[model samples]
Structures are given as structure tokens and as C-alpha cells.
Target: MIRPRHILRVFLLTTLLTTCLTGLSACGFVGFPGVYKIDIEQGNLVTQEMIEQLQPGMSRRQVRFIMGSPLVEDTFQPDRWDYPYVIRNGPDIIREAQVRIFFEGDSLVDVTGDYLPSWANPNAEPQGSTESEETEEAKES
Candidate 1:
């Protein structure tokens, strides 16, 4: 048969466990809080409104008027303009893009890309215009 000392030991163990659980529950011991932000330094996300301002038939000069100078331009691929921006949520975490704009002659032709995630294809060729033309197409079709 169990002695009274055994009953006391069990009671002490249960009380210790309950006290520890209660203390942990009261403190910030679970589920870390998250922070949200906007207007990143490198990733100033150009809004859709800005893109909507651009039209299929807009000239390269017009696109410049809308989006400002690009962040990068290739020496060999002058038709390709890259707008790179980044947003840092915290250390080691970032959201960014180099929104590529491609031109054929002087007409703004296509969006090369905007890579936002780490897993996306960073080197996907700008979407349109395989050949850089000498003159802008007089009118878009």
C-alpha cells in the first residue's frame, strides 16, 4: 500500500507543474508578434496606378515621364531598362524588384519583369522585343 509520503510527493509534483505552466502562460512565452511595413528603400513598390498610367502605345519618352529613369541599363541592350527597388522588413529579410521595361526603337514595347520573391527566375529575359528596331513602330497594333 502507498504511504502518506507518496501522496505528498505526487501533490508537490502536480503543484510544481501547474505553477510553471501558469507562469509561462502569463508571460510572452508563445507566438511572437509580427511587424508590418511599407515604402521600402530598394523595394518602393511602384503601384499599379503608375503602371496603368502607361499605355501600350506610349513612346519611350512617355514611359520615362511616367516612371522616371530606370535603375539599370545594359551597355549592349540599350532597349532594356531596369528599375530595381527593395524593401527590407528586417535584417536578412527583403522584398525587391528590378521592374524591367523593354523598348523597340523609341516605343516602349514591354515589361521585362519585376522579380519580388527569392524563388522567382531572376534572369528571365525582358518579355518582348527580341530584336531592337532602328525606329519606333509608327503606331501600335
Candidate 2:
């Protein structure tokens, strides 16, 4: 008692349902609420701790040894180096920092951007404890 017309109707209905389901998923609606994507991190991981280690009068090799190679070193401005870091989760940026190091001749002279150097503190003594022994002995007194 199977009719050809009834079989044709069922096939058309199934095809339509399949098409609708495919469209919904293609539009990002099927698994919309609970999906997760890993955060993406790019460029140098310049940190405050690293910046604190920086000292003026340090040579280029010393800076590179401490902070790693700069992410952006301008061709025309050979003495300037830029460190940039960023983290993104999908379309949202979670964190970012930029630090610029400037050199006079071969020595690091100035640093500007996200973090401050340790020597910026008034109480902080110059690095390497280059002060005279008498000054240190006097301070102990």
C-alpha cells in the first residue's frame, strides 16, 4: 500500500531538515555557549622584573644578555630597541606592554615605556656597588 507521492514527500522533508541544521551550525549557533579558545601570546615577554635588572651604562652585549634580543630594532636608529608583548583571547586583547631602550654610542643611556628601571629610585645605589670603600664604611658607621 506504499504510494510514490508519500515517499517523495518524506524525502523532501528530510532534505529540508538537513539543510536547516547545516545552516545553523555554519553560522556558529549550534555550539555557541560553551565553546572555548586558547589564549594566544605573541612577541617578547618583557616583564617588570626584567626592567628592574636594567642598568644605565651597560653595554649592548650586556643588555642583550640580560633582556634577550630586542623585538624591534630600527635600521636607521641602530641604538634604539623596542620590546613589545601581547596576549589575545579570540578577539579580546588581555595584556600588552612596550618598552623602548635608547643607547648613546654603545652604552644604554635611557629607557622609556611600560616599566621603570631600578636605578630610578632615589635610595637605590648605583649598580655593581661601584661606590668607594670609604663611602660604604662610612655608611656602616
Candidate 3:
């Protein structure tokens, strides 16, 4: 036989159990609202526009002026300059770009890395070299 007091107690227990289950389920999301995190940029942020300004014949001073000083300069490899850029949004990495420039003697010779220069293409000809090559070919013929 269920009395009114027993019914009241059962209802209270059911309500408490539902509340506990709801709270436990909500524990998965612990983040607060209205909070914002800023993205962090590290190392040299080399851009395509900056790379486009670089010419093969540009001096070290000129390259430094255009692309800024390299992040890593090895004493062993004085002619090799490495420019690396990394973006971080909290714990996750947003993007990374690495550009390596090689110099022969004092002149910038070539660039090879994960990034492609703006003017780097098989059909593209560097400034002054093509004209000199054409003149040389004519002379040879």
C-alpha cells in the first residue's frame, strides 16, 4: 500500500536523479562564454609580396631590407638564410611556411623550400639573364 508520504518521497528522488544526470552530462562543456584568444605569430612572417620584391642579383643588404633578417643564420653555412613563419591559435597550429635562400659568394643565387616564389616558374626567365643568353646564342651562331 502506497501512502501520500511515500508518493511525495518517490517524486523527490526522481527529481534529484534527473538533476544529477543532467549536470553530469553538461560537464563535457566546461568552456566559458564571451572569452576570446588572440593568435600568436612567431619567427619571420615572410609574405609572397615580400618575396616577389627579391631579385636574384640583390645584395645581402638589399635582401635584408626586402625580407628582413633571417630567423636562423648558421655560422657554418654563411651563404644560406632560412626564413620560417609559424602561426598558433592557442594549442593548435594555424599555418607554417619556410623559405630558404642560397647565396653564392655575395650574390643571391637560388631559393628552395616548402614555399614557391612569386616569379618561380619553368617558363619564367630571370631579369638580364635571358637577354645575355640570347646575345650569347647569336654570337655562337
Candidate 4:
């Protein structure tokens, strides 16, 4: 002999339990602990060593051989090629790099963006020469 009041109370408790469980399950979708995220890599991978191989007068074919195919080539600007790379962990970008190469006719003319040839990098230390040695040589000259 179940009373009407007892049935109503049981129904309310069940509804409340279900609601709480549903709410807790949604927390995982919002980046809760223990959630796994895979790193995503996109576009061409260009390295400083590859950039150093480039020379100002190299042909487009040589440039492509050293740097690989560019990620973007503008239709409106046929002489420009863009290489862009990115790594992401979920929605957060961990790393990004870009390089733009310009050609004049068949010859490579200019390069810009995240990397440059070692000869073109002003911040790069001169190979096999220390600053002190260079200063001493300058003083002698």
C-alpha cells in the first residue's frame, strides 16, 4: 500500500539525481582534468639550416629543392611564395612560423618572415670568429 506522497517524493529524488549526473558529465566537455588533447601540425616545415642553403641568385627550381614546396602561392602575385607552419594543442597554438620568398623572373630575389639565411641574419655570430678577435684585428688594421 504505497501512499501518493511517497510516490511523489521518489519521483522528485530521481529527477534531482539525474539532473546532477547530467550537469557533472558536461564538465568534461569544458576541458576538465584527465582529458586528452592531441597536437596538430599544419603547413610546411621550414628550418634555419634549409634557409641558410638559399642564395640570392638561385633559380626557382633550386629554391624549391631547398625549402620544399611553399604552402601558399598567390595567384595575383606569381613571384611570391609563402611558407607557413603551426602547431596546436587543442585550441591553443604552441608554435607558428612563416617564410616568404620572392622571385625576379627565374632568379630568387628576396626572403622574409620568421627565418633568414645565416649570412642575412644580423644577430648571428660570425662563423669561426669571436667578437674579441675581430676587435683585435680591427685595431691592428
Q: Which candidate tops lDDT?
A: 4
**Which residue pairs in model 4 clash with each other?**
none
Which is the winner by TM-score between candidate 2 and candidate 4? 4
**Cα miss at 137, model 2 (Å)?**
26
Per residue, candidate 2 scores C-alpha lDDT tens digits across 29-62 of: 4446667968999888887888888889999999
In candidate 4, position 8 carries an lDDT of 100
Q: Candidate 3's C-alpha lDDT?
A: 0.84
Clashes of 2: 0
If scored against the real structure, what TM-score would every candidate get?
A: 0.48, 0.63, 0.59, 0.69
Give the TM-score ranking, best first: 4, 2, 3, 1
Q: In model 1, what is the error at residue 57, expressed in angstroms?
A: 2.7
lDDT of 4 by residue, 53-133 (tens): 999989999999998888898999999999999999989999999999999999998888999987666787888779789
Question: Residue 66 in model 1: shift from native, Å?
Answer: 0.4
Residues 18-130, candidate 1: write the lDDT tens digits. Answer: 99989888755443467444444763356656765765657888988888877777999998887877766544446666677778888866774553222234554544544
lDDT of 4: 0.91
Worst lDDT 10-window in candidate 1: 112-121
Clashes of each: 6, 0, 0, 0
User: Which residue pairs collide, candidate 2?
Assistant: none
Candidate number that wins on lDDT, 1 or 2: 2
